[model samples]
Target chain A: MTTTTIHIPTLETERLILRAHTLADFDAIAGFYASDRSKFVGGPMSAELAWRNMSQEAGHWVLQGFGRWILEEKATGKTVGMVGLWYPAGFPERELGYDLYEGATGKGYATEAATAARAYAYDVLGWTTVISLIAKDNAASIAVATRMGAKADGTFPHERFGETIIMRHPSPEGLS
Target chain B: MSTLTVQQMLNSERLIMRAPQASDLQAYQAYCASPRSSFVGGPFDTAKAFEKFTAMAGHWIVRGFGRYVMLKDGIAIGHVGPLCMDESVAPEFTWTLWDGAYEGQGYATEAASTVWQHLTNDCQWKEMVIRIVPDNTKSCRIAERLGAILTDEAAPVWYPDSVTYRLYAGAA
Candidate 1:
């Protein structure tokens, strides 16, 4: 039996292990999508959609050479959220995105995970700059962007998501 | 168990069937945009089709075995083989040729037959099934030619309109 393999790099943070999404991660992802917390992240979907969504995330790594990572809390080895570089078909530019599962917010997990993702984008991927596209009313996510030194640059007219605010992260040179 | 690279999954006389790669997205998206996609529940918007394409490629990592894109003369014409969305459900044998220009030829059947043999003989899969919407007579015909038997078993709830055809390892 020959099996195909996709190489997704694993990164370590102070409190989280940013790693490839495993099949087991689907349970947590489906749960998140089923909840209201997924409201602004194209969620409130059925398990069927969630299954495809997880696969899309994994496939993104293969196709795009970069994609989201599962944010696992080191203390408990439990999944906290997913955060990484996102440049899907609809996006105007490559963006850094994060989604914290229900009960995982308010602990700075999103902020911590996103910071590492942005660093990977600039340092490893050789990206000069990246943006974070947040839903108009997602103040919590906006705050995370602010905490990471991203400034609201403009808004993008998303076909499905409507208008989303685009926060530009500090350029690699600007950071230094 | 041996390991094959992405481009070496399976092969037939006129087609090289391999794991879906980044390069296969364009043709796949074009198919999703075409009206001919109706039989497969498509004609999806760009975003939806992109997600579906990525998922198709990603399923290989998730299940360790997945559908392969059929390349004829270095161009992707279609995809075929096993797909299991849920662990509890039986893996399905599926086939889709992207363009109507390639239809009426035996491409889909040939690709499906090659994949079926690879999975059943080399991979040691004992049983698998094919689910097709009743309106997709072309695909149903391929299932028939592959020695699949129509079964009374209900299709997966996500695809309620489909009918099931079971294929045993030795039957083919």
Candidate 2:
């Protein structure tokens, strides 16, 4: 595996700014995961869990040449959430994933940021395929997957959640 | 609101879902030829099957939605889609694979159910649709298992050449 790091100072969308997660983002990131809202977004990620997740995301950039990005509000500079690519436990391939704070729901930020990441995966990283695994009951995520042009390949029994869907996207060269 | 990243869609599991490559074409072609490929018009010729596979992949870039080539042990077997079919009441559920060797295994159900959950719950799609050919007993069963309701309505004219079909409806 080639370990390449691309310093993305900031990735701008209509309403979001995708950047690297910094130590300064800890408190806000922790709060987002600690709230009850985290359950719906990502199911009760604790402060320690959030910190670990952030650190792991940062590690992905260094180790895999790509990783999840910290999402901030461009207008306010507030840390809203995090989204990006990383290997989920047990997955045979690299998967696409994301999360947002309670205050971030119902906005198009997920779609915008995810689309940018997909583009980066293909155009920058030269990936041919990307996958997104989502819980069965999480409708918000399904819509985002659809809007992003991902298709459901099937489902698998999850250790925590009963079952989850696996969605796929083709690279610029096209689908397999 | 924070922007969404591709990572949010993944959950920790034994297998990871990713895109298919050109090298997968031959294996995919063989999959389409398998007897269990019935759910997706099994027993297909390689040339035509490749055409269909490429078309589905194109939808990812053009429509922002398309099928994912399911992988296991580094081989392509089946596919699932957050598909949008106009013939029914709404865009609907879909899944298919080529290997009989992989059948009876819960892989299809696992992948489809995950995507469906994301679509209805996380994505907030209000209504979704799925249309199965009347003869495709396996697909019909799978759709029913997903809680898709069968409809009496006849399929539209634009549908690919197929016999009678049962429409299944679900929350968007």
Candidate 3:
């Protein structure tokens, strides 16, 4: 319910484990922003900026109690990337966020992780609604949202990414 | 110091090298709002500046090390210290002085020198490098003054032509 340094809730799906982000995940997070692939997120940045972003994800857990999570592949116990609830300052509303490393895509991992996260947000966090802000060019993410029962609901003029499609979770309670 | 955290301080003459604070948003926002901020991806409005400012303070929690808020006479003029991003091969020692009024006072060299020692001697880092856009001669001079020798590379996607200077831990 509230911030707890003692424990963090971890979620598991068929092939993935969604857990709180740790410094161990910093390199994956930072390297993502450092590469060209980070273009969809906010990337190709300097190390300090990448560190700043990695710190934000970790800080979000402490401050928001529930923030983006590290997506670990159960098959290898490797952190592929991050996904979960992201409601940072300046957000128009609470959002369902996700991102994956280069090698992790095209395997339905994003859909699987996002579905678990959406449920955690609705059932555990008790949020009435959750939205995923997909950049116009982020076709893969849009497809994942679609497969997870999200639909194009509106558009948000995001400060960084400009126009973004807001996809609403089909069921506010999350898929049972 | 080897045991340094974001909240720790490295005090020296004419400056206090401590971690960033929540209250730094104002001075940071003002600095980023000015045209002089172009070198650092600034000229941001209040909202953008707010995001950038908070991120500076928030970075400490995840990384365990970040820039300290540089203070003179108990006022925040800017930040300085060991900076390393996710993609960096090694950390960089820098004094990112903001506010045009605070320039040319030799604080960059002083703070950077102090930070370099702390990072090398106290922290025991093997080596560190500074990445600067080629046109920023003032910062380049500071790096040179700190005994950093120029070697190209380490530019981000935006600043493709940036100049990199490496400072070995053994340098005086």
Candidate 4:
């Protein structure tokens, strides 16, 4: 049986446009992860790591009917960062994740892109629950999660990320 | 300011806010349909849940701010955003995790904190309130975590069903 590839297209928000990843974005992705300043921004991702990450993002869209979109500047057309859904093996659960360059911080892009992706997920894809795994000490991320209406349940120890907070957003139907 | 677009009102760690679509109905319906879920008033039917989602989306246009649908991993789990209370008291901070499987996962706090930050920091709202029913210990605890205060004041008669309530307000 031939499997059909699901095509999740680029989504546009008020300030940013979420689109599929392309090889052209490599330089921008590399620049962000390669910089020491990017440490606190999101990942300590190296250039090669960022490339792998982008590839994985594209792969997710094909396998999972939904995935993160590469965030691009509307005017400059620069790939400032990435934000969207990521489903890894052993963890069939859907997760909301993001990574932005040093220059992208403080602009509310993370929040903006995330909010749009969430709407698409709930309203479009019909996902019942969404999770965000953040390092406990990542104060900036914690603040972002709070802003998006995510509530932290508890901390889970991750071999790779250390102690991470598991934030949950159930479903709108349950909200009073 | 241009009526806060779904994008403008949204605040999340990794997703953007947008208008609701028909596609979210199934996930939302499943949550409301679940028996184990603890909604504010209780479980809701599909019609009611849809109405609520529409109302929340409309609030962004009517009140300039309101609750928003939450997205994670390309799926809609629940909603967290600003909501108007009676207007007589401080604006209430509200949230709900409709999916039973999602509970105890910390996503509620994660999502709610974002809305709280927007209200306090971005929108510059003076005070925020979280009213919790006495029996709902989980909600009461959540209110406490957000730094809400419990008062001796009698529960408002409006919600006669609410036997007891605690008021959580932001610091002045």
Candidate 5:
């Protein structure tokens, strides 16, 4: 019985390193889910549920061939957020998502990380276009999407979070 | 950190236990929707079920090992293995039959026995634990047959109502 291992690709930006998640990231993940900032992303959940959520993100890569990555600051080697491609069940289409930890947002980390993720989706995975599902009230995220040249295409109603705005990014050709 | 890796597939006389895959999500979602899933926190909506399925696969990446789908004749019937969610705790050896059609066939015990050896012999795990709800007689019976001793330790804080059992590496 030979053993098998999985490899999650790492993406690099100018200042951030998007890499596979480790168990070591659980504490930082739990902290994000516990804070009010996580509200738009289906969070403010218990630490136990948070563990499951992180694992879900990691598994997404295996099941889908591409998933989210932990955003690490190259200078400090600190985990600042997560950004990547996502398309879970019930979702209308594939998405490019991003989330920044407390004290990490003002620096455009989400935009920077998300640009790399979107490029991977379009250039590497050959995806034509992608969308981001942002809570209706999340202006900061909306701003990030705007900066990425995404426009409000439609809405997706979530069971727990109410109506969400689906912002569509530029097509692969449009980006070039 | 030690790199923990488990065999992708384990073959028993009557079952093939393998790691969960992308193709297994549909069956898992169906299982979660059925009444059979009531015991293990199921009957989830499609969204939640998808989350659970991905999480199951991610557990392997996060902890270097996770549950395996019990494939009977190439169909995924259920999953069995040790799942360690938190680093501070022992991994729980869990087993489930996704559909009622697969129940009462003694498949759980067979697959479980094979998994036990893989974890103990191949993976070198010294201790294993299981948590079962008091009313889940079938799961309780499986625990007993595996030589897992009923322990005074409470279940994980998240599942307080359940009872805990422990099986040492050499005891089973």
Candidate 6:
């Protein structure tokens, strides 16, 4: 074995920052995965697995040039969630996914970080479009998508994650 | 970002210890997919297992040391290594299950010894501690076999009534 480094720019919003994941963020990620709320995004797992997920994020940066960034609250530097591009094996498109911690919701953190990430994807990464594979029954996330100007392309039956709504991103220039 | 360093494969008299692969997920999950897995917090669903599976691999990245998935004839059998789980429960020498058709073959002892040597010699872990649930006689026996002496320390906050066994790799 070899150790490889990944280059990811630290992105900031008014209230949040999209940062690379660290070992310290494992606890919060683990908590998120170990709860019923994790059902939509493959969660409610042991902490050990959560560690793997966070590692994947970092690894993704190295392998894919872009990955899910840990969403941090700028006021206190606490990890509140993760939002970024996710396109693993068998994934159809570069997905713009966001998952917030339990208490960090109802305040627009996901939208803020996701909006910034979308801009970064288009402006810096020069990607034309992104998609978020939202679980069909995940009303909360659908609302977040709508707020972010994402329109439902259609529903796709995912083998592992069940019925998923493919929410397509609007043109970056169109979003005011 | 914690980057996992791929440590070299280790060999024992009978077993090979290597970094886990994506294919080993099923075996690792099945090992803990039963009611008998309570000791290791098992009987979990596939999703959680996937997470747990990833967590073990990630542990290697975060802690600079973690157990290798023990193998016999290229088949994954067990996991043996050091893990730094949390601040309250940092750096543990753990020996876990040797799966189906391969159980009780003394693989645990061989694998543990090999890993102990690797950590003590290569990784420079001064001493290693094995955390055991008080009633986990199976693990207690393995800890004793590794020459780990029981220590009178209070249980780490994670699991109540846990006992600790200490091993000094320097002495060996």
- Clash pairs, candidate 6, are A33-A44, A48-B55, A49-B51, A49-B52, A52-B54, A52-B55, B67-B81
lDDT tens string, model 6, A1-176? Answer: 32233356889899998987777888889999999889998767888657667766654554456778889898988889999987664577889999999899999998999999999889999988899999999999999999988999988777667889999989866764
Those runs of model 3 whose alpha carbons end farther than 4 Å from true positions after fitting are A1-15, A20-66, A87-91, A100-112, A115-129, A136-152, A157-163, A169-176, B1-8, B13-23, B45-64, B71-75, B85-90, B104-110, B131-166, B170-172
Q: Residue-wise lDDT of candidate 5 within B89-134, one digit each (tens)?
A: 7778899988889889899999998999887887788788899998
lDDT of 6 by residue, B83-133 (tens): 765545436788777464676678887888888776666666667778888
lDDT of 5 by residue, A1-176 (tens): 33335678898999999999998888889999999999998889999989999999999987888899999999998888999999998888999999999889899899999999999998899999899999999999999999999999999997766799999999998888
Residue clash pairs of candidate 5: none
State the lDDT at A130 in candidate 2.
88
Which is superior by TM-score, 2 or 5?
A: 5
DockQ of each: 0.59, 0.01, 0.19, 0.01, 0.73, 0.13
* Superior candidate under lDDT, 2 versus 4: 4
User: Candidate 6's chain A scores what TM-score?
Assistant: 0.94
- Per-residue CA lDDT of model 1 for A1-176, tens digit only, reads 24245679999989999999888888899999999888888778999889888888888887888999999999988987899998888889999999999889999999888988989999899999999999998999999999999999989987756679999999999888
- The worst-scoring run of ten residues by lDDT in candidate 3 chain A lies at A1-10
Q: Mark the regions of model 4 whose C-alpha exceeds 4 Å error after superposition.
A: A1-3, A37-45, A174-176, B1-172
Task: Give the per-residue lDDT of model 4 (tens digit) for A1-176.
Answer: 12233365889998899987665776777787778645543456766455445544554554455777889989788888888886644342678887776578999999899888877888888887787878787788878878888998776665456678888765657432
Q: At residue A121, give the lDDT of candidate 5.
A: 90
For candidate 4, give the docking quality class from DockQ.
incorrect
Q: In what order do the candidates fall by TM-score, top score first?
A: 5, 1, 3, 6, 4, 2
Residue B69 lDDT, candidate 1, scale 0-100? 90
Pairs that collide in candidate 1 are none
TM-score, B chain alone, candidates in order: 0.92, 0.74, 0.90, 0.76, 0.94, 0.86
lDDT tens readout by residue for model 2, B44-109:
766455545544543332233445556676566767765442223455456776677777777777
Cα displacement (angstroms), candidate 1, residue A72, comes to: 1.2
Return the TM-score for each candidate structure. Answer: 0.93, 0.47, 0.66, 0.47, 0.94, 0.64
**lDDT scores for all predictions?**
0.86, 0.63, 0.76, 0.64, 0.88, 0.76
Instruction: List the candidate numbers ranked by lDDT, top first.
Output: 5, 1, 6, 3, 4, 2
How well docked is model 4, in DockQ terms? 0.01
Q: TM-score of candidate 5's chain B against its reference?
A: 0.94
